[model samples]
Target: MNSFFDGYVNSKTTLRLFVNQYENALRDKVEKENIAADFHSFKSIVPCINHYDIEKQFQSVYTNSKFQEFQKELTRKIYYYPTFIKKEGAIEVYQVTEDMRIGDKRKDVVYDILLNEEEFEVKCSCHHYEFRGILCRHVLCLLREKRIKEVPLKYILERWKKNVKRKHNFIRCTYSGMEDTSVAKRFDMLCNTFYEVAEVGSISDESCNALVEAIDKLKILFSTNLDNSAKDLHVQEGPSCDGKSKTILSLVAVRSRGRPPTLRKENKVDRKSREKMAREKKAKKKEKENNVKGHSMEIIKHNMNDASSAAGNLASQDEIAQTVLVNSSAHYNTFQTA
Candidate 1:
């Protein structure tokens, strides 16, 4: 002790004393306040998760229940931690000791999985702290043995969801005394959107269904079944119509009216006097409608004639077709005999 003190006589001695005193102070505060304690969920998961095989690849990795249980505890520690502990009201403690391998091995093998009795290193695929939201292949392998169809909702909601919120740095629980105006506005809008769409005391499934229903209703309400622009155009200039079908071909309608060739500016529409324009449009529309009705009547007459002709053809060819079929079948038989 004297030699140690003598070696750091001047500046070094002061620094050493300072570090030692700081460490002592921090240690005393922690011990006195009992600051180190796992959350409630930690205690609950420790017992429940104590003995679960996480690896079907090597189910023998954890030969004992103790190791499996320990592995679960380790999972909660790595994945749940602050969120799980905060939420799980039942658990008050979660504790585990280091593992001891049979023969001395490399550091990698030693701690690959040393949480409780759980053979984590061998069984656990997600060894790191993150990547716990969705079950890794290793956990799924274990769950399959236990016949768990899917990862538990408890793990997904309380454990995984909370972790995701923390990782992504989600919204503050309450925006108390927040200074960012833009953030506050956006948050408010989000809340408004949710409340507007979601009913009181609705479950997630119902809420999602309700949102879909609302979206469908909105779509229907905003849908355009008819073109209002056509109505407006009809009222505005009588009819800028040609006797032909309404098309790009009839845009030069006035030219076909035997008037001197007159070119309107690119964007301008030369009506050839509004009264004359109105007369042409009315006459053109009457002509077009008459033509359409005549065309429809002709189509109907043609269809009826076609059906009649087809019927006569079928009746006349029926006997001939049957004779041909009989002759072909007989020929096939003759070829087989030859």
Candidate 2:
């Protein structure tokens, strides 16, 4: 049993080490990929083919991949022409037709676009922004007709932004032994906030000293609160009723919910020990048998000596009787002669 437990513990340790190594390797791989992506996006520049101010804005803000997608829609805007339909309150509706050509077939697809000029918001029936998070050619065409210089800030998704720092990127990988807990997320958010503060604070010596002092005060305050809370938790006891403490006194050892384990297979050490015990037991039994036999022989010899002594006493008694009889007969014959 001890050996089995030892083996189980060793295997668990080995498995944990393997998992740690694998997680480290996976984290390194992801870091390399992210670095490579950043390098590629930074080094390579995609020229603005449409020469539109909006295309240039997208090229500067969006990553290379997302910029290419926007460029495709920008280039395809020539095929779409928007016609003003009607105005309803704040929204002006327009019908945009696309002159799409596939191989040898030509198809015209009409899409309805609602434009809010006041808010600079555009919604298209193609639902490109809704699905793929990119403005459709129809909406771009309508925006072009309206002479809008750039896309709205709301339409530009943070996920595809080149400069935006993603929160998930700060989160440790799933296999990196750090769970994606709310605390971790909050920590990342706080780190970003503090980083911005640090950047601003470092602009001047007074601001930097003030920031450091404030951070030290906050750290002390938080530490004190944590210690107090921990102390309170430690002093708190289990609930009691009617002045009686509800404390667990003892626990019974319950059998596990399974069939009892069979005898373990004997290893070389166990086998040798068992054989040694068996040999010692057999020798003890033989010694006990010899002692019993020796005791029996002594008892027989004692009984034989007592029987020989009784026989010798009986012979002496017979000789004394014969001598008394001979004397009696001699006395009778002398009396007769007188």
Candidate 3:
């Protein structure tokens, strides 16, 4: 103790003791009186924090349960007295210890916190900020010990903020029509829109069934229309490569007045083939219905015949029973007379 006091006197360390003691006394008084500091609204207390950062902190603290738990932990006396080591540059280091004891266990967790005092940046060895995008209790405790009244803006990550997705370019449609637009582009748009509707409709079975029925109706309508309009289309030769004529002809529509060149006609043979296919389908469906009805009628007739046979057998059994009773009565009377 004498050597420590002598070293303190020699190094003139006690010169700043009055200021440190005064801050400690004020903190103790605040704690004793239950006076709380409003970190959100205390703009002048902590450095490098503005109104925008305050709003972001509020949003993150309220919405994130983990952050709320961290706040609760910050209120507890978990961290030990932080020790600072000043370096030659703007970066300084703080050592913090936590009493992680359970029922007399002496386990202590220590962390090295790095702070750029000039830039108001803080980081801990736990990597809580790196992994979870939030300041750890070690850094928060050091900040409190240093008399910082508000958290710095650099500690508040953008991802946790409520206004993260407010920008217009975050999710924009990429399906603008262009000269290079192909079937794939239309297909991509189709899938995007279809999935949006499907996701909503998939919430309930009724909605899903409604969507399915609507799609079925659309399919029928499109198929019938395509079959009816097939004859108006024609096939023509397209540009070939390497002086080779391509066997596959491109289907082009017969031009009409006031019609765009992009319009293409369906092949006449395709229309006839589609009509034939539809007729075959109808014929098969009718045959299937007739077969089902015939099978049902045969089942009914067989059941009726079986029921009549059963009724006749029951009647014969009753008649036989009556005859046996009469014979038994006659035998009894004869025996009595004898």
Candidate 4:
């Protein structure tokens, strides 16, 4: 069915598409120097999104194939600019007024693009050439629209929706055991990007060294910590609150204390009893009404019979009176006292 929401514009995505189209059109209209100048002008005029923040937000969601596709699309818009992903689609701009349930905030923004038929809203932040992630505000905005969950990755793409084969091949390196030369280089990289200095005893040191990127490795050192904390608290409801959670008795701490009233065990019987009583009352009322209706019908039938009998008797009486008058007149004409 073509429902109410089917025709509604995706305000955010439309605005994003508009901005993208506008940027591209302006670039095409100008010289290379003008493009560089435009970049500078755009930076000064528009708010910039932080690259690090976006990268961190994206890191958790990047494993999905759709997200990877979006990344590829963004890459094309920038360095690749491939002709395969057609740029002929119309970029529509719109505005949306969303009332957030949680924060209770109403947002009004100059929309960038309501693109991909409202699949996603395209937004820009100054830090990088790539798209922005679901910032808390963006999430709130979507929730206000009653979207219920995070926006999917496909709607944010700037290029083809398919993943492209990586252009660069991995190069293998030979290692010598003496100095562990890769370690120092990796350590320096980590220090620059992450913490300033990794402790000797810390697992941060493991990723700091060149042997491996610190994806999820090096948790052995903190295994005991993770176990003690994870076992204590539930992962679903909340994070470990000082790790004091007990499995069974934790509810006791949260539950109110008092001499509570006793609860009935046989609630089903009570409900059934009440329902039976109500049904009996309804049936009795119906029977009484039926009896009244029957009595009224009998009375009406008797009244109609009485009316018919009275009319027949009156007609017979009229005929007899006429006959008697005719007889009297005939006797008078016959003459004499006889």
Candidate 5:
């Protein structure tokens, strides 16, 4: 760290260098990712092991990595078997049992599956789709049993689609030397949209002609609107020669030439102080809790003592009344005898 700082005149320069290097690394990583995606786009897809239409559909739609995950589920579906349990209206209940082997010990794991016939929707107790966004072997086995040729469109998430355009890809990187303006971002978005449209339109002559006609109409409308906007701006300005020049004041304050105030680099002393404060706060909290608990216990003990004393006093009063009654009865007997 000292050697790196020695190369720079000030900490600010060092920080700027560090930030530039980090951005460059990020940009390189993004480029690599793009290259990989392009490679995947050109590469031939892996042949389906099961040769199922659903497998081929997934292979075409999903990225290579995600498709491999689906393929694994497809291969593993053999271990799962779905048995019809009962039917209730449009929904059918099936008990799917997976024969899984772990370290030579085999166990049967049961999962409940609900199939909606009308909607062609299926849900499994395994919750694999809910958690991983991928269908589980149990669901696949059930689908196979039901003879569903293709996976539902709802199940194929856009996040895993191979040809899906991501907004972040068009955003300018910090080290790219390009201004990250809204106009540039909008242009990139429009280009991506047009590229996708062109790809689709090229599929047939009718679509190509329709797309060209629509673009021509849009161009005419945009040109008319621009001409009207320019005329209105010209009218609003009145005359360029008659406009007065106004002076703009400079900023009152300039930013300091050092590390930014928002960025605080914690050293050993600061970290230790923070840790010490945290420990003290925790100790104080624990002490307060203990005091509260002790106070509660004291109150409970005092209440028990008060209750015991009151019971003892009642018992003494009863004994005194009994003694008085005995004495009064003896005296009455003596008088009667006299």
Candidate 6:
């Protein structure tokens, strides 16, 4: 039973904020030297990594276990090179036909390697690039076998890069303590002072203790000022002519271009009355249908009775004509005998 206006604050944005904070925390744990070894090629493209996404690789390391395992798997390829299948124009095909031990169990895992020598485009049957946006061990092995030192810029994804653009100011709509213009200005000044205090307080424990004491004294001063302001009779000045008090304009509700609606014109019927009318309408429709059905049945019965009576009358007339014919024949025979 959620209302239409329930999500005033975007849930996705809020969730993203939490995720960014988590990433930032993980980013602090990442060692820059480790990134230099693993993502050396990435450093050439971007000068400095985004502080927020500094631990992107660290997060990916735990999430993509297959990728971490693949790094170790590439060592086995050093012993054997993939079988060359065929070369068609710019593309070359290589096949890994033998069974390899992956993870726990040894299984027959066949992978076709398609390489474009001219364009440096590489594709594998395992589709590791499509799945995880990184090259599989098979392709990496091929590169190592070919003595390619650096990974191509085309293959490296921008999102996985260390120096991708970072969003600094994410604060959109934040609440201000004061509503009045003058109060808001004073509050801004107070915030500046608080920020300075916080910087000084962070130096040492003694300084922090002194800062706390000062804050308590500042609160007392603010309380006294609040009391003085409360006691003062503030006058609200507005537009005035000469020495006379200004007249405040009243807000009038504007009427549309139509005659004012009378109370009788409005549909003020209660819910019960409306429902009763609907029920009556439905009942009348059902009664009308029943009456039509009854009339049709009565007409059919009358037609059947008229047809039966007509058939009975025709049979009686036929019997009477047959008796007359038999009597006339007997009289003729008697006259002849006489």
Candidate number achieving the greatest lDDT relative to the actual structure: 5
For candidate 5, the clash count comes to: 0
Cα lDDT of candidate 1 equals 0.41
- For model 3, residues 1-338, the per-residue Cα lDDT tens digits are 33323212232334465344333333333333221222221212222223333334554433344445445545553445788776658888888877786886878888898877677878789897788766666776777677666676666665444223223222222211122345445656887999999998899999999999999999998978765654332211222122321122223346688956656777999889999999999999999999999999999999999999999999999999999999999999999999
Q: What global local distance difference test value does model 3 have?
A: 0.58
Candidate order by lDDT, highest to lowest?
5, 2, 3, 6, 4, 1
Q: Could you give the candidate ranking by TM-score, starting with the highest?
A: 5, 2, 3, 6, 4, 1
Please tell me which predicted candidate would have the highest TM-score against the true structure: 5
Give lDDT tens digits, candidate 1, residues 107-221: 3221222111222212242453234333333333334333544332333333221111122222432212222445546777878886865664265887677778887887676
Clashes of each: 8, 0, 4, 19, 0, 0
Residue 337 of model 6 has an lDDT of 100
**Model 2 stretches astray by more than 4 angstroms:** 1-21, 99-107, 173-338
RMSD of 1: 42.2
Q: What's the lDDT of the predicted structure labeled candidate 2?
A: 0.74
RMSD of 2: 22.0
lDDT of 2 by residue, 57-118 (tens): 88877879889988888888887789988999999999988777989999988889998888
lDDT of all predictions: 0.41, 0.74, 0.58, 0.41, 0.75, 0.58
Q: Model 4, clash count?
A: 19
Residues 172-247 of candidate 5 have per-residue lDDT tens digits of 5453333455545677889899999999999999999999999999999897766555322110111121122222
Error of 3 at 48 (Å): 22
Candidate 5 off by > 4 Å? 1-13, 101-106, 176-338
Error of 6 at 87 (Å): 0.7
Candidate 4 lDDT by residue in tens digits, 40-77: 43233222233433333343323243344334433332
Q: Worst 10-residue stretch by lDDT in candidate 5?
A: 233-242
